[model samples]
Target: MTIKSFSFSQLADMRIEGVGIHASYSIDIVIKDENSSSGKNVYISATGKSNAARAAGTGSLLFWCKVRDLLSNKIYSLERKKGEGFAVGFDDFVIGSIMFHIPYNSSSAPKIELEAGYLYDAGYAGTVIPFPRSLKRVIALTQFNRR
Candidate 1:
C-alpha cells in the first residue's frame, strides 16, 4: 500500500458578494492505494473561515473537488452525499471533507490532475474560485511504486 499527500494554503482572501462570502481557506488531499483490485481512493479536506455576513437566504457557500486522469482525459467530480456544503454565517468557520474512488488496471499507472475550490451560489447564479495555483497539481502514481 502507498499513500501520497499534498497541502495548500491560500495567500489572499477570496470573496463572492453574490452570496456574501469572504474567506481564507486551506485544503489537504490524500491519495491511497492498497494494491488491490478495487483501485485507489482520493480524499479531499477543506478548512476555512467566513469573515463576512452571508446574504439573507440568498445563496450558499460550497466546496468542490475534481480529479482528472491525464492519460484518458477523463474528469471525475466529488459526489456530495449529505447537504450541499457548510452552513456558515457571519464570523463562522467550516471544515469539510469528501472522498471518492478511482478504478484502474494494475498493468499501468496514470498521471492524475486534481483541482479544488470554493463555490458561491445565489440561487440565480454562482461563482467558482479555485483554491490557488499551488492547490492544482499533477501527480504520477508510478512514483509511489518505486523502491
Candidate 2:
C-alpha cells in the first residue's frame, strides 16, 4: 500500500470568479492477487474537500491515466477536462478504491507512470478569466516499479 498528495498554499495569483474549490486528496494502489501472474488486481481511490468559493456551487471531480513506465511529463491541460468526460461532460464515480486487473510480463510487476490533477470549475467557463485560476499539480505515485 502507498499514499501521495499535492497541496499548495498562498495562491500565486490563483483565483476563481464564482465557484472555486479547495481539496486535500489521497490515492492508493495495491496488488490484490498473487496467484496467476499477469497483472494482479489493482485498487485506486481519491478523496478530498472541494468548495466553490467564487462562482456558483457547481463542479465535479475527475480522473485520467497514461501509463508509460509510470512517469509522465508535466503538461497543464484544459483540453484534458473537456477532452475526457469531465466537468459538465462527464459522470460521477464511487468514492472507494476502484478495482483494475493489471497484467505483468517478464516475471516482474508492470510499472506505470501516472500524471494527473483535480479541478473546481464554474460549470461553463472552465480555466477562463472570472473563473478561478486552475492548477495542474503533478502527482508521482512511485514505488510501484520496485518489487
Candidate 3:
C-alpha cells in the first residue's frame, strides 16, 4: 500500500502547557496488490508523549481519527485518549492498540483518507510534548488452514 500523509502543522517537539491544540493531518492509503481481499487487516496507529503526567482528573493527549473508504463509500471514525484511558506518569501513549479491518465489498484498493487531530485536555491543563507519528499498513491476511 502507498501511504501519503499531509499535516496542517508539523507537530514540533515543544513543551505544551495548559489547554492546547496540536496539528491535524490526513493519511492517504493506496492498495497496490489487486489480489488483496475484503476484511483485510489495515493497521492505523498514532503515538505521542507528554511533558509530565496528567493528573487523575485531567486528560493529557486526546486524539481523533476518521477513516473513509472511497471504494465502498463507507466511513469509520473514533476518538479517545491517546493513552487509551486516564493516565498518570509513563510518557508513552497509544490509541488502545487497535487494527482497522477493511470493509467488505472492497475489491478495488479503496482510497482511504484518515483525518486525525490532537488536543490537550482542559481543566487540569496538563503538559504535553508532541511527536511526529503516523503508522498505516495494508496487508492481505487469510485464515490459515493449519490453524
Per-model TM-score versus the true fold: 0.54, 0.39, 0.43
Is 2 or 3 the stronger prediction by TM-score?
A: 3
- Badly placed stretches (over 4 Å) of model 3 are 1-9, 12-43, 50-59, 81-90, 97-108, 124-147
The lDDT per prediction is 0.52, 0.35, 0.43
What residue runs in model 2 are displaced by over 4 Å at the alpha carbon? 1-13, 17-37, 50-97, 124-147
Off by over 4 Å in 1: 13-22, 36-59, 79-109, 122-135, 142-147
List of clashing residue pairs for candidate 3: none
lDDT of 3 by residue, 12-93 (tens): 3324443233222332223221223444455554443443224333445565556665555566765564445543336544
Could you give candidate 1's per-residue lDDT for residues 19-58 as a string of tens digits? 3323454556666645335566655444433332253344
Backbone clash tally (model 1): 0
RMSD list, candidates in order: 5.7, 7.8, 8.6
Judged by TM-score, which candidate is best? 1
The superposed Cα distance between candidate 1 and the true structure at residue 109, in angstroms, equals 4.9
Q: What is the lDDT of residue 138 in candidate 3?
A: 33
**Highest-scoring model, lDDT:** 1
**Candidate with the larger lDDT of 1 and 3:** 1
Worst 10 residues of 3 by lDDT: 26-35
